[model samples]
Target: MEGFQIIRWLSSDDTAAVYEAAGPRGRRLIYTVGHRPAEPAAEFSAWAERLRGVRHPHLAAVAAAGLTDDARPYVLCDTGSTTLAERLVHTPPGVNEVVRTTTAIADALDTAHAAGLRHGTVCPSTVVYAADGTPQLTGFDMCAPALVKTARPGLYTAPEADPGPPADVYALAATAYVALGGTLPYVGDPTDPALRLRGITELPGVPPELTGMLRTALNPDPVSRPSAALLRDALSTVEVPETVTTGALPVAVVGSDVRAVSSGMTTIIEAVTGEQPRIGREKSPPMPPGLAPTRPLPVAPPAPKPVRAKPVTSKPAKASGRRTGRRIGVAVVVLAVIAAGIGGVWLWRDQFAEATEGSSAIERVDFNAIEFTVPADNDRKVTLTGGSATSTNDDGRAESWTLTDGPVFADGNHNGDQDTAAIHLVLEVRGSKRSYVLLFTWDGRPKQAQQVVNGVCDVTDMRSAGPGIELDLVSANPFADCSALGKGDTRAETITVAMRGGFLMETAPHEGATSRCELAPGAETRAQDGDLPVRVAADAGAPELAEDIDSVTVFLPETAGQIQWHLARVTLADGTTTCGWVAAADL
Candidate 1:
C-alpha cells in the first residue's frame, strides 16, 4: 500500500480507484483498491490478504493490501480498463462472449472457495473488463467473515456465508444473470438498490434448464446450494452459444443497401465479361477436394477503337468514267441478288434443322414424372398361420400359444395403450422375414390385440431367455389379464387357435370381503364359493376356463361375507365351494 499511488478514480460510490505499484524488480502493475470508509483498516487488510491467495482467470489478482497513509483501509487488486456493466452498455456482446465472461467469474469463485475465501460482493460493477475485453472480478473489501452476512444495498449478496459453499453459488448465479442480458426475471427494477440487495431469487422467465441451476445456486437455504466446483461443472453443461436476435448479424454497418438479381442474368453477364458477379451467382472456381473457392473479381471489357473513314473523291473524267461506273453498278446488283437468295435458303434450312432437333430431343427425354396415389380408405386385411400351443399345470391349468411372423403395431397416439383396430394382419407372405399387415376399422371402445406371429406371445423379458426367440411386450402398460398368457414350454407339435375376441372384465376377489386384489397365472376363484382353495379332481373333464388363470389375491376387510372357490378338474367341467368370514378391525 505504501508503494502505490492513485492514478485514476474508477467509481466514487464504491470507492474503487486505480493505482500504480512497483514490485521488487521495479516492474509496475496497475493495482485497484476498494476505498470503503465503513470497513476497519485491520479488517480490510485481512480481507485483501485472503483475496491475494485466490488465483483464477476471472478474478483480479491481488498484488498487495494494507492501511493507507490516512488510516484508511484498502484492498489492492489488478487494475483493468472497464467493468462488464460498462462493456454491456457500450459494445454489444454475443452469447459466447457472455458465456466466456460468466465462466471466468465462476472459475474465480471456484478458486476463492478452494482458498477458503468467498466473494461477498458479486455484481456487474464488480466485474472489471480487461484491456483485451476479458471480464475479471474485483473489489474484496466486503469479503470479510468469509461470506456476506448483512445486506449491502445494490450488491448481490448470498443468503448465508458461514464459510460454506452455497454462498459462493448464489454470488456466481447473480454474476451469470448479469452476464446474460442483466434482466431480472421478476417484475422489478434491477438497478434499484432495494431490489438488487434482495437478489435474483425467483427467475421464472429464465430458461427451464438455467432456472433450475440458478435456483439451486440462489437457494435461500445455504445448505441446498451447490459448491463452487459443482457449480463450475453445472455451468459446463450450459449451452451458451452466441446470442441470437432478430437482425443481430456480426458486421455493424450503419447505412447499407442490399439488392437481388436473377440467376440467369447473372450467369450471362458473368460469362460475357468473364467477371464473377455478386448476389451469390458467380460460378464456383474449380477446387481440389476440401478446398473453398476464392472470392471472384469482376472482369473488364476491351476498350473500343476510334474509326476514321477514307475521303470521297469527285469524279474527274465525264464519259468514260460514267460508262465504267454503270457497268460496275449492274454487276454488283446481280451478285447481291444471288447472294441474298442463297442466304435465304440457308436461313430456312437452319430453322428446319432446329425444329427437327427440338422434336428429336423430346423423344430422348432424360427424365419422366411418376405419380403415386394412396387409396382413400387405406385399409388392408391379413391372416397369419403356424403357431404352437402348450398347457401348464400350476395350482390350476393354463395354456399359452406363441406366434412370431405378424406385423409390428403401435398405439400411434402414444397414450401407453394398444389399439386393436390399428392392428394390421399379415398379408401376402413374401418370405419368412417380411409379414404384411392389414389395417382394421377403429372402434370407439378400447380393443386389445397382438400381432401374433408363429404363436409366441411377446412380453417383457426380465432375464436373458436366449438369442433370436426372445418374448417382449411392446406396450409400457401390459394388460393385467394378459400377464400370464406368455409363460409356457415350446413343444414340437403345432397348435392352431383363432383370435376369440377380447373384452375387459372386473377382476373377482378371492376373498368374500371387497379389497385390493391381484391375479396370478394358473389361479382362479369361483364366484359362488367363499375364500377356500379347492383342488381339481383328476377324473373330471377340463372346464372351459379363461386362457391365463393366475393365483387370485384378495384384500379382505374384516367383514362377515361369503367367499367362493372354483375348481377346474378338466377342459369342460368345474366344481364350486363356499365359505364365510367376518371382517376384523385388525387382521
Candidate 2:
C-alpha cells in the first residue's frame, strides 16, 4: 500500500501481522500482512480485491495493497475503535444500540454476499464500533470464493455452497447475536475449534426475525439460505427501534473493571468499619412495650407501701440474728442444686436435637415441583412449576418455590424492605443436571442457604454430605502453577475424579500434572468420567490441578459467595478433551 505507512507492529495471529498504519492523509488504518509462503498472501489479496469491488458502507474499505519489507502481502483498511468485546467490558452499549449496530452489519453482509464476497470472520473481535457508534465489519482474512470452499467454523458455517454464501450469513447472524447480548447462540465448548463451525450449521433460537434469517442463512442445503443481497435487504427491514431501555443501566458495566471498582469500594468501607459490607440493607424491627425507645431500659413502678414494717417492730436481737444466718445457708444450697439441674437438662436437649436433625434439614426442602429437561446437545433447562417460592412465615420452612429457567434472577424490592432489595434467585442449569439456590436471605434469617437439588440445603459456610460436591471454584492456591493460561481469558478445565481418588485426563497438552491452565474466554468443557455428565465453564480465575491427581480439588475462599462451574467439551483441530466432576456432592 503506497499511501499507507506502518507506524508500529500491534499483534499477530498465525496468518497475519496487524500493524498501526497511517494513510497518506494521516487517517489511521489497520495494516494486516499475511504470513509468508505466498499462497496465503495471494488468497488474502484476491479476497481483498473482491471485497473492494463490493462496496458496503458498514464494511471497511480496502485502502491500499502490496508487499512490505519482508515481501509479505498486506492490505490497508480503516481502523475502527476497539472491538465490540472491549467496549462491552468497559462501556456496553444499550440494547437499542446493539440492535441498530446489528441491523447495519446485517445490511452490509447482505450487500457483500449479493456481490459474491463472503465476510468470513464475524466474531466480536472483528466487529468494531466506529467513533460515531456504528458497528463495522473489519477482518476478511478468511473470506473465500462464495461458491468454492467453506471458510469458517462449521458450527457458525453453513452446510450448503460447499463454501457457500449462507455460511457467511450464519456468521453474520452469530455476530449479531453476540452484539445483542454478549453470549453465544449455543452454550458449549468455547475452546472447541469446532464450536463456531457447528454454530454455522445449526439453527439456534435467536430473535424471531434474526432467527428466521439465520435459519435461511444456515440452511444445510445451500439452495435454501438467502443470498447475501437478500439477507442484507431482510436485515435492513428489521424494525429495530432507536433504543432499548433495560429498566435502568447497572451502576457498572458487565465486566471486570466494574467488579474491581465495586470490590475496592467494599474493601475501603470494610476497612473503616472492620466488617464486610452486608449484601443487603439492614433494618431494625419495632421495639416492644415497656422498653424505652432510645435505650431499651425498663421503667420501674413506684415503691410498694412501707407501712407493714411498722407492725413487726421489736423481737429478741439474738433470735433474729441466728434465724437469718440459717435461712441464708439453706437458700444458697437450694439455688446451687437448681442451677446444676438446669444446666444438665440444657446440655441433654442440645445433644438430642443435633443427632435427630442430622441431614433432615436438606430433606425438608421440596423438590417435587422441580423439572429437568435437555433442549439441545450442550444445553439444559430446569423449570419450576410455580411462579416464586414465597414464605409468609419466618420459620425455616418451605413456603413457596421460585422457578427460574436461567442462572440469574432480578432482586425485586418488595415489602419496602431495603435488606431484601438485591436478593435474586440465581440458577445454574447445564446439560442434564439442575441446581437451585436462593440468592438472598430465606425466612428473614442471616444464615444463607443454597438448594443443591430440589429440597436439599447446601450451607455455603459449611460442607455437607449431600449429592453435590462442595468445591470452592474460586479459592487461591499458591502451589498450583496456572501460568500456562492466558490473562483476562476464561476457560473450563476438566478435572476427573476417579473411584480411587486418582485423576486421569482423557486428553493432554497440559505437559505437567502440577502445571496450571488458563481458561480461554467463554471456554466450556464436559466431564466425561462422572456418573452424570456435567458441563463446566471457567467464569473466573485460573485454577490449578495437581499432578497424578485422581480427584480434582477446588479450593474456595471463605469470602466467596455462590459460585458455580458447568462442564463442557473442548475440541481443538486435533482432538477432543472431556473433563467432569470429581464427586457428586453439592456445595
Best prediction by lDDT: 2
lDDT of 2 by residue, 81-144 (tens): 3455444432345555665676777777767766666555565556665545567876664443
Each prediction's whole-model lDDT (CA): 0.32, 0.34
Q: What lDDT score goes with residue 250 in model 1?
A: 13
**Cα-based lDDT at residue 534, candidate 2:** 28
Among all windows of 10 consecutive residues in model 1, the one with the lowest summed lDDT is 328-337
Q: Model 2: how far is 269 from its true place, Å?
A: 35
Estimated TM-score for each candidate: 0.34, 0.37
- Give model 1's TM-score versus the native structure: 0.34
